[model samples]
Each structure stands twice: as structure tokens, then as C-alpha cells.
Target: MARTSRAPRADAARNRDKLLAAAAKVFGERGLDAPLEEVARRAEVSIGTLYNHFPARRDLIDAIFPVRLAALEQVADAALAEADPWKGFVLFVEGLFALQARDRGLNDVLARRYPASPELSGACHRGFVHLVEIIERARGAGLREDFEAQDMAPLMWAMSQVIRETADVAPDAWRRFLAFHLDGLRAGAAGPLPAGPLTEEQARGRPGEPAGSPGR
Candidate 1:
């Protein structure tokens, strides 16, 4: 027998969730231009159903991109609540890497559009701040090397870049690379190029036009 869904309102919510799930898969494969009709088909709904939930392209993109950003906050909250800061930090890295792996296009899309949505960027910044606290506590406990709070953002961004690119490879391969960075470079806070702590003017994502070009 088919499993019964909830009341009418709850069933509507389930349909919304199904559409989003289908959209995530479709968008992950094709990026922002994934066909909404295919998404509706995958969700076993009509095109009208898809529009009923998300009427515009930006709305659909918002559903896919920023939702993961919000999920980052929840992961940060969970990890920070754990007993060991170092353990928490590891969880944070793994969670972030997993997010990128789910949709390889996500990093590129976010790198460009992160600045457009204050809420998405702010959530990421908050998550990084939470990680900074963890890093400081872990260093204070002598479990990790020293890193200034400002250094955290760039370092995290760099590591995120590495992980995003290396994602979908063998899991251990990425872990080994991360371990090298953590043990040799990041663990010591020593680098040829110094990055001061985050400033009031600087934001989380790297906001710049494409190389040698105006207006992308």
C-alpha cells in the first residue's frame, strides 16, 4: 500500500520538498540553468506546481544556493557544541567539503553570487566566526597552532577552494591533502604571504570581476 501523507497543508509542504530535492539534483548537474520543467517532471508534478512554489529564476536559485549556506550555520552550531574544539573544527571542514562535493558547480556559483545575497554571505561569515572561536580555543588548549581571527577567513576560503576543486575525487585523497595543509602550513600559521585578520571593509567571499575584465 502507498504510504499516506499528512493533511492538505502538510502534503503541500511535502510536494514543495520533493520539488526542491529534484531541483537540487537537476541544478547540481546543470548549474543555474537547469530546466524547471524537468524538475517538475522528476518531482511528479506539473510545471504549474513548480511555479506555485518558485515563480522566478532568482527564487529557484535562492532555493538551491542559499539553503546550503543556511545549512552551514546549523552544522557550525552542532560542531561548536561538541566537547573538543579540534573535533568540532574537523567536523566543520568535512561538512563544508561534503557540501561542495554534492554539487561541484556550487563553488563557482557561490564565488560569483555570494556577494549578491547578504543573508547568504552573512551566514557564511557567522559560520567562519564560529570556526574562529573554535580555532582559538583549540590553540589555547594547545591542540592546534596559532592563527589570527582574520587569517581564518582567507585560510578557510583557500581551503574551501582546494576542497571544492578536489572534491569528488577519492575521499582519502582530499583528506591527505588537507592533512598536509593542516600539519605543515596552517597548523603553524606560517606562510610566505601574510594575511592580516579580517577588516571591517573586507567580506567573506572574494568579490572581484573576472581577470583583466570589466563587468562580468
Candidate 2:
């Protein structure tokens, strides 16, 4: 009787794994908004089974994305491990955009297409902590002093569009764009700009409020 009960539990676990794998493949190919039916189809599971594993679209995304995005932390650690701060910063930035270019689902996550996913939010917050260290280290080593962590918001948003627009037609187009941006970020490239950098709130998708303040 115990063996019989364990068999059912093991089967359920297998089904859940299949659903997650299918969802990752589907979402990576087609972005986060891809239909649930495709995930179920790819998993070779009934729609009921897929729903049993993940009741809502966000639930499926929450399960898959946080794990995938954990790779970002690995990238960050690699960057920090580099001997040269400027090189580390470049590695971090290039690594990030490379991941975005490769994965449609991650591109959507970086773009904040689904803001309601608490898992993704937590992942992003952790990424930002690494970004701050990367930015400051780079600044000390010839990155523009005035460039703030918040500036990464616009840079990411811009690159997100470039990746989307050029993914099929010119998959490496973002590389050229990134080269130009990296040059502009050098200390010698600094010049007076028309506007100031974004606030921390703005960087985090909550504009018009000071950092650490109430949300309303």
C-alpha cells in the first residue's frame, strides 16, 4: 500500500517536471505570453494535467523563470571575479544582453512585461544589488563617474527593443549597439547631458517616488 501511494506521488512529480520543461522551451521560443495550450501540447500532457501542475499562467512562469534567472547571479559573480573592474563591468553588461538576446522569455522578464510576478521581482532586486557593485567598481576604473545604477534602466529598455527588433533579421545587431553604448560609458566619453539620471524608484518601475518610500 505504501509503495502504491509512492508510485502516484512519483508520477505526479514527473508530470510537474515535464510541464516545467515544456513551458521553458515554449516560452524561450515564443516569449512569456505564449499560449498555455502550446506548453501542454509540448509536454504531451493533457490540459488538465498542465493546469494541475500550474493553475495560472503566472504560476507556470513563476516556477520556471526564477530558476532560469538565477543564471544572472552566476554571471554577476563571474564579472566580479575578473581582475579588472572595467573588464568586469563590460562582462556583466555583455553577458546580460547576450542572455536577453538568446531567450525571448528572459527578454520579456527584463522588460518588466509581467510586473505582477513576485518571483521575478525578487530575482530582479537581487540582480540590482550586484549591478550596484559592478557599476561602482567600474566607475572607479574609468567608467563615467556621473553614470549611476539607475542609468541601467534606460540602457536595458533600449537594448530590449533592439533585441526584439533585430532578433530575426539581424541577430547580432545588438552587439553593434552595445559596442557604441559601451564606448559612450567610458570616462573620456563623458559630456554634459540634457537630463539627470533616473531615480531608484524609476529604475524599479515605480516612478515619481523616492526610494524606500510608500508605494501609493
Candidate 3:
């Protein structure tokens, strides 16, 4: 009886593993909004089985993305370790965009598409702390004094759009955009602006949200 009971548990574990693998592949290719049904089909399991393992989409996202997003922390660490602050900052920004360009689901995560996942939110928060440090260091070196950590959100959003639009037709198009922007961030290139940068809370909120909207 004990051995028979163990067999079902083993099968369930296998199904769970298959679901995770399928979800990762489907989500990576199609973004986080990819249907759970496709993940189930790719896993060769019933939709019920997928739901059995991950009751909701956020549950699956929580499982798959936190581990992947952990790499962002490592990238930040590498940036911080670099001797040149400006180079370090560039490394962090370029590394971030490159990762997003490679994975559509990750791009959505960076854009805060699913605000309900605790794991993803925590990961993003931790990454933000590192970004603050990187920006401060770069400012001390040669970055524009007016540039704030909050400014990166709009810059990243624009880059995300560029990557999405030109991925097939011009895979390296974002590089040109990034270079132009990086130059503008230089202290020598600084100039008066019509408006100030967003507050951290405003930056975290959806685009066009009122300045007072609660951040996700």
C-alpha cells in the first residue's frame, strides 16, 4: 500500500516539473500573457493538471520568474564591482535591456505587467535599490546631475518599445537608441528641461497615471 501511494506522488512531481519547463518556454517566447492552455499542451498534460500545480497565472509567474530575475542582482553586483562608475552604470543598463530583449516575458516583468506577484515585486524592489546605488556612483563620476534613478523607468520603457518593434527587422536598433541616450546622460550634455523627472512612486505607476496614483 505504501509503495502504491508513492507512485502517484512521483507521477505528480513529474507532471509539475514538465509544467514548469513548458511554462518557461511558452512564456519566454510569447510573453507572460501566454495562455496556460498552451503551457499545458506543451507539457502534454491536461489543463486540470497544470491548474493542480499552479492554481493561477501569478502562481506560475511567481515560480518561474523570481529565479530568473535573481540574475539581475548578480548583474548589479558586477556593475558595482567595476572600477569605473560610468562604465558600471552603462553595464547595468545595457545588461538589463539585453536580458529583456532576449525574453519577452522578462520584458513584461520589467514593465510591471503583473503587479500581483509577490515574488516578482520583491525581486524588482531589490533590483531598484541597486539601481539607486549605481546612479549615485555615476553621478559622482560624470553622469548629469539632473538625472535621477526615476528617469531610468521612462528610458527603459522607451527601449522596451524599440526592442519590441525592431526585434525582427533591426535586432540591434536598440543599441543605437541606447547610445544616443547614454550620451545625453553625460554631465557635459546636460541642459535645462521643460519638466522635472518623475517621483519614484510616479515612475512605478503605469504610464499616464496621475502623479498621485499609488505605486504598485
> Highest lDDT: which candidate?
2
The C-alpha TM-scores of every prediction are 0.63, 0.90, 0.91
Clash tally, candidates in order: 2, 0, 0
Q: Which digits, one per residue and each the tens of the lDDT, describe model 2 over residues 83-193?
A: 899999999999999999899888878877665467679977776569989989889597999999999998998898799788889999999999999999999999998
Q: Which clashing pairs does model 1 show?
A: 150-197, 150-198
lDDT of 2 at 29: 85
Q: Stretches of candidate 3 above 4 Å error?
A: 208-216
Judging by lDDT, tell me the better candidate of 1 and 3.
Answer: 3
C-alpha RMSD (angstroms) for model 3? 4.0
Better of 2 and 3 by TM-score: 3
Cα TM-score of candidate 1: 0.63
Residues 1-216, candidate 3, lDDT per residue (tens digit)? 999999999999999999999988998887777888999999999999998898888888889888888878888998999999999999999999998888878877787655646667787878667998999999958788888989998998888878867877887899999999999999899899889999878897755422332221
lDDT of 1 by residue, 1-216 (tens): 235544766778999999988988886765455567888999999999888888865566666666566666777787789787767776776676566556644654544433345655554565455766666766644343545555545554665566555555653456666676566434445545454456745634465644432111
- Best-to-worst lDDT order: 2, 3, 1
Against the reference, the lDDT scores of all candidates come to: 0.62, 0.85, 0.84
lDDT, model 2, position 165: 84
lDDT-wise, the better of 1 and 2 is 2
- Model 2: lDDT equals 0.85
